[model samples]
Target: MDEMTWLDYLPVLGQGAWVTVQLTVWSTLFGALLAFAAGLGKLARNAAVRGLSVAYIEIFRGTSLLVQLFWLYFALPLVGQAIGINLRLPPVTAGILALSLNIGAYGAEVVRGAVQAVTRQQYEAARALNFTPRQTLFRIALPQAIPEMMPPFDNLAIQNLKDTALVSLISLADLAMRAEQLRNYTQDSTTIYTLVLLMYFGMALVLTAFMRGLSSMVGRWRPAQR
Candidate 1:
């Protein structure tokens, strides 16, 4: 077989990278939303709300994301058939759902911890201003806690990006999957894997820079000064 140039494999890998990026972006967005909702739930006055949130976090955190992905893509269809319901998910949908749920579980802990770390003085001040618990949480506690949350959130975001590779196992055509295909076809495992590894590293660096900028902005956001 003739030695294929890197250029020969670039297009296919580029397409795969696009899918991976989309998965990472969408999953992170949804996951963050879930994180906030569940985090707040953990602190809710209602026992039922707190119980439900704890259950969700524990269930997802306890399971492997790969198994979650498979359950959604493969097992759900069978379960649906048994129940006479169409619960089948497209590969991309399943991938995004699994990634979002998995990361959201872990992220909820970050959210909870950061919010809880807010000083008692801040809460007392909010109360002195006649703020309800909800108002205090949203307006005062959150604003102060957000910056503290950023570093952990940034780490979780990077982890979420790497986890997108698991979707490739379900045939979602992500970067890792594309690299595997190219390696099999060209029999250049070293070259294909090295490039794939570099691509992932480049993405991580870019994400780190973006997170740093966001963290800086958050750190500078002083409501009192405004």
Candidate 2:
């Protein structure tokens, strides 16, 4: 294979790149949901729940994701044998779970901070209206939090997209893996990585546009876009 064949790898890049995007999108979506739940649990008055949520957020945030990936991909099997429930997941599954948990940790802080930024006056007014805590949270507080959360959430989504490249290390055949294979076959590291970089750049551009659109939509919902 030669530099001329770089063009031949474009379709492969597209197909492999999509795998990265899929991992990020699905994992981030699920992770954001989990993060919100964990964050809200942290805010709860129940000590045990708050403590557990705190522990989870700290442990995930404190550790290196690469290390966590190693543990999930390698270590769990040793411990799994004792329990007889296999923790050995495919590279894709392990990647998803690790990324999701990582995102959930950071996302938990984003959720907590955004929720806290909701004004005390709003909470008082909701109280005056006799709205229950749940109603106030769902209807009043979270509405206000949306605008604030949008920027960070968008950033997190993009960050996760980039981070998904690490999944290729586990042999998930993502963009990086495809790039590696191309380089190995062609022995042209320059063009191979160049195309891979371009592929990543394109994906980031698309994600940025989508995120901007989402921010606009959220702003409209908040009556602040005007």
Candidate 3:
């Protein structure tokens, strides 16, 4: 066979890139939902709700994401078997779960901080208007907080994108795994790795731009702080 050139590698790498994109998109979407839920939960009046949210945020944030991924992909099934349940997840599902949980934990703090930063007066105004706590949070607090959350959320989104490479460890054919496979077959480490680096950079750039636009849109809804 003719020696595979860089051009020849594009198709395979592109496939891997698509998988990486899917992982990032799904994980980030789910992570954002978890972040809002847990973040707000931690501030809830219900002790049990607050405790559960705290526990989730701490457990995922405190642990190594790589270990979490391994535990989900490798250990959970064995635990399930011992308990007479089938808990095995597909590699892609496992990867998304781990990434979402990990990023969500960190993003939870961002949500909590931003919400808390909403001036006390805002809450007072809500109370004056007879707004229920839920009304206060959704109508007054989150709208303001979301704009603040954007910058950190953008960082987390990019971090999540890069972190998708870890899924390759579970034999998900994401970009990094594809690069490794190509390197093994081609023995052209320099070219393959360089291309991989460039590809990741390109993806990050696009994600950053998207996040910025989202941030701007959300910021428009933020009422001017007194």
Displacement of the residue 104 alpha carbon in candidate 1, Å? 0.3
Please write out the lDDT profile of model 3 over residues 16-91, one tens digit for every residue. 9999999999999999999999999999899999999999999999999999999999999999999999999999
In model 3, which runs have C-alpha deviations exceeding 4 angstroms?
A: 221-226
For residue 138, give model 1's deviation from the true position in Å: 1.1
- TM-score for candidate 1, please give it: 0.95
Task: Itemize residue pairs with steric clashes in candidate 1.
Answer: none
Colliding pairs, model 2: none
Off by over 4 Å in 1: 1-3, 222-226
Over the stretch 13-48, how does candidate 2's per-residue lDDT look in tens digits? 888888988998898898899789888888998999
> Tens digits of per-residue lDDT for model 1 on 56-167?
9998999999988999999999999999999989899999999999999999999999999999988988998999988998889998888888989999999999999999
Q: What is the clash tally of candidate 2?
A: 0
Please give the TM-score that candidate 3 achieves against the real structure: 0.97
- Judge candidate 1 at residue 119 and give its lDDT: 94
TM-score for every candidate vs. truth?
0.95, 0.95, 0.97
- lDDT, residue 40, candidate 2: 87
C-alpha local distance difference test of each model: 0.92, 0.87, 0.96
